[model samples]
Target: MVEKDGIVRVGLDAGMNALVRPAMYDAWHDIVNLQRIDAPADGQFDVVGPICESSDLFGKRRRLPRDTAPGDVMLLADTGAYGHAMASRYNLRELPPEDVIDGPVA
Candidate 1:
């Protein structure tokens, strides 16, 4: 996480490596901080990745919990196949494992 020019930026571990639609098509993905689901959204943040490129940003001016911090579990909603199908090891980043459930998850 970083704060510069009064703008908060949160770096995510899951980047173009797992979802490239954001960087490739400038797509908008609903970013949710699972840990702060019930917390008030008092912070504006730019959700980014560790990739060394300006296009690695996933979201901008995102409203999230004011105390969003490292180790927080985040979810990029509505990715579908466009995001996952285009994932690549462009930065030599290893592909993360994915879980598929057979039925509705509790």
Candidate 2:
């Protein structure tokens, strides 16, 4: 959901149902474009989820790759500790499917 205003609207498959930290306390999550790690930061972005509420955001004014756009897989850092554990059924959005990475840490 990249907008013309230079704000990338990133919608996650899951929203408040899978992570409430952001909407609850204005938590800040680091976002990175793994495919464009070397790209420069062109402007700010609003990394959000698919939730209906406006508070269902991951990061505000986040600095990401200048070429960042829709369909690009961005990594939300530091969510392993309490991401899925804090999920709920709010907004009737289903929780995101879980995955287990069985390899060396990148």
Candidate 3:
């Protein structure tokens, strides 16, 4: 995991021969526990999404803070690099909206 300025970068794979992080040794990521902000974690877990697919997982047995749950915003750290760059509009699903965190405004 490499750091440029202050932001962390995370890589995610969609199975199908795709690999995230360790495979490429690109960026560093942190598994944030969006559920419980003040509690301790019992164990690690594989954070998944509701996309209904085998490769729709975010992290695998990652150690988080605690109390993560549905409707909570769990951030996949350091995903700004190849995350949006490799987005596809498959299954008629709309691409996620993008927000500009920095840089000059147009």
Candidate 4:
């Protein structure tokens, strides 16, 4: 994560290899800070991945918490249907791991 001029940029652990919807379709995914889900959005962000390509962006002008920082876990909402299914080996990046959350537990 990096911040400049009140714009936070978040680099994903997995790049286009894990999700291609955004880069390929200009898709918009809701990014939520798991630790501060209810906090007000203090700034906009360019959520991207670690790939070298310019199309590796996940979102632009995404609003998130002001204190969001590196190592913070975030959720790209509504991605279960297309995120992993569209993954590729581009840039030699590995696919993201899955974590199953059972029931209504948070």
Candidate 5:
């Protein structure tokens, strides 16, 4: 996960990671409040997307700050395994672009 311009970004690889099953199986992640809490605690969250769909989500029981909002950005950790790769062009939705961070992985 990486943050730039107050926006946090996460990566995923479809070939190796399981996306849909995680949510279906009731999995979740933690959303650390880096700005407010000097030491944030681990909590559960219902990780989801703004898009309209029943399966559009990253996690079910994600841990996040109690004050999370729509404008607040959240980086779904360890998503570099399935985030981008599994995205579909559903409803003519465009796929998210990728960038090389710190000069690409070896």
Candidate 6:
């Protein structure tokens, strides 16, 4: 994680290998920190990935929960089929099996 010029850049563990929409179609996915769900947004961040390429960005200037730190469980909503189809084993990354949930969990 790095902050400069009032812009915070957050690097996640996953990248284009796991989620390619943002890198491919410039898509938008709502990023939320489950651990800090009830907490108000702390600030905006440029969520990026571990990849070395510039297109590995996840989101730009996204508002996230305050004090969001490493190991925090974050979710990118609506990945759907596109994300799965575009997934790859780039840089020896593992493709996690899909866990399809058709509806809300009780």
Write candidate 5's Cα lDDT for 1-106 as tens digits.
Answer: 3344654433222211234444455445444444445534444454545453656556544455545544553444444545566646655555555543454556
Ranking by TM-score: 1, 6, 4, 2, 3, 5
Better structure of 1 and 3 per TM-score: 1
lDDT tens digits, residues 1-106, model 4?
A: 7777876788878677787888888877888888887889986789888986888888998889877788889888777858867777776666778775566745
lDDT by residue for model 2 (21-48), tens: 8888877778887778889977677878
**Superposed model 6: Cα runs more than 4 Å off:** 101-106
lDDT winner between 1 and 2, please give it: 1
Work out how many backbone clashes candidate 1 has.
Answer: 0
RMSD of 5: 9.2
What would the TM-scores of all predictions be?
0.88, 0.77, 0.56, 0.84, 0.50, 0.87
Candidate 1, residues 48-102: lDDT per residue as tens digits? Answer: 9888588888999999998999999888887876666888897799876665435
| Candidate 6, residue 20: lDDT | 87
How many collisions per candidate? 0, 0, 5, 0, 13, 0
Judge candidate 4 against the unseen true structure and give its global Cα lDDT, from 0 to 1. 0.81
Report the Cα lDDT for candidate 3. 0.49
In candidate 4, the residue pairs with backbone N, CA or C atoms under 3 Å apart (3 or more residues apart, or in different chains) clash, namely none
Instruction: Give model 2's TM-score versus the native structure.
Output: 0.77
Q: Using lDDT as the measure, what is the rank order of every candidate, best first?
A: 6, 1, 4, 2, 3, 5
lDDT of 3 by residue, 31-77 (tens): 56555656676646655444546555556556754344545545555
lDDT, model 1, position 69 = 95
Off by over 4 Å in 2: 2-8, 100-106
Give the CA lDDT, 0 to 100, for residue 34 in model 5.
Answer: 45
Task: State each model's CA lDDT, in order.
Answer: 0.85, 0.75, 0.49, 0.81, 0.46, 0.86
Clashing pairs in 6: none
**Better structure of 4 and 5 per lDDT:** 4
Between prediction 1 and prediction 4, the one with superior lDDT is 1
